[model samples]
Target: MRNFQKEALILSVRNTGENNRIVSYLTKDEGILTSVLYGGPKSKLRSLVSPFNSGTIYLYNDEAKHSSKITDFDVKKYHLSFRESLFKTWAATLAVEVVISTKCAGSPEECFVMLNGFLDGLDLLDENQGQTGLIRFLWRYIGLLGVQPDTTNCQRCHKPFYSGNFSQNTLQYKTGGVIYSHSENGFVCTDCYKASFDNPERLLFSEITSKSVVYLQATSMCEPSVSRNMKLSDDEIASLKGFLYSHIESSVGTKIKTLHSGIGIL
Candidate 1:
């Protein structure tokens, strides 16, 4: 009758029969953990096991049978604000799906810290601010998960993202901007793109605006614990939303159902 005590972030919950459920959690010690909670909707324990909630959890591990069951869950932060609005819920759900997809590839502790800041920022931010924060969070999470986009330089040419003679100024970018090449699986500089796609139909991709590239570079270096009030313009938001979501969708290899279905609110 082994037992385990851990601090966990509840990622998802699924009903099992009429009186039980299976809950998945992200813990500091274990990357992802699933345990059966023996209770139904009306049970107090069930209510505390909500997704995105984080806190100490007690599990009774059946070592002989190799399974675990939830005995207690002491919620520290419900992150109830995610449930307050559909916009927040979409971003939160997307984050959960991404985490589950990646299985928190890096160290469990680092992944936990990253997700903690993400939920905290979402809770404090309004819809618009949450959009920026969500972009930041997804980029950071993908980076940690080893699928981050390389917006800094061209894959073929091996030069810093440049246009005309402005290579000296890394801050300035012009031209038709960078292209997220599906075949190349990275950004291509103007020269490389034109040389490769001469009089061709680029059916797989469109240009990622210079501004979007800059945003990608900026957020890539920025820490995940950035302030919640971080803002972006409407244009920036739209471009980033498309670029980040598409990039994540491609990386995760699945349709981002939350974004696809929540198009109205999102």
Candidate 2:
């Protein structure tokens, strides 16, 4: 039996037999992992395993079986503020679902930090402001997961694009990502922009949305405190919500049920 301890954020919890539970968590050093809490419902550790709970966790690792068990944990923050309203809870749920759906590809530290920052922001937000934080989180998470819209070059041509040279920008749904043009209604790589004549999947990202995404990325890459102050227009917010959700749906090949049910709330 090997043992270790680290600070963790509880992503979710599931009851197994009687009182025992399987708790899933994400940590900066350890990626996402799950461990069984041996004690039943009455165990102190069970309640602390609630979603969005941040705490230090001790574990029993069985090297022989390549598994781990949560022996004990100390809850640092329970995030009770989210429970005050449905919108807050749903926003938190969406954030958690996004984390659960997207696998960690590179260093887990960035993703962990993003999750913590999202929760911290949630703690101080009201219904009207929560959506901005959630949208910021989704964009930052998409960037972390490495599926964010290509901003530099054409996905098809692999050539650099200058804003001054392009008159329009459009996001390609099929192959080419973002495109820019000086004369064309849709500015993409010259190759794909022309290809759109036959391919109907390409859609133009409105000027407000394209600029908003760039602004969101710029601020998110810096301090969360600064990102929290970021704002979006009604149209920009709606467009952004569609864009991020579409990206996630495309990646997972399925619609996020919560996103549909909770539409217009944010």
Candidate closest to the true structure, highest TM-score: 1
RMSD of 1: 3.6
Q: Which ten residues in a row have the lowest lDDT in candidate 2?
A: 165-174
Write down the lDDT of every candidate, Cα atoms only: 0.79, 0.69
For the record, the alpha-carbon RMSD of candidate 2 to the native fold, in angstroms, is 6.6
Residue 204 error for model 2, in Å?
Answer: 7.8
For model 2, how does the per-residue alpha-carbon lDDT over 1-266 read when each residue is reduced to its tens digit? 88999999998888888877888999898789898887766777777778888989999999999889988789888778887878888888888777777655465788888888889788887767776777788877767766566555555676654343221333222233344332332234545666766654444432223455444545545555555654567776776677667666665556777788888664
RMSD of each: 3.6, 6.6
lDDT of 1 by residue, 1-266 (tens): 88889999999999889899989999987789999999766899999998889999999999999889999999999877877788888888888888887778657888888888889879988887888888888888778868776877877787776343222343556556777777556887777777866555455565767657766676776543332333457876787778778878888887877878878776
Q: Over 4 Å off in model 2, which ranges?
A: 65-67, 150-199, 202-211, 220-227, 264-266
Top-scoring candidate (lDDT): 1
Error of 2 at 139 (Å): 0.9
Q: How accurate is candidate 2 locally (lDDT)?
A: 0.69
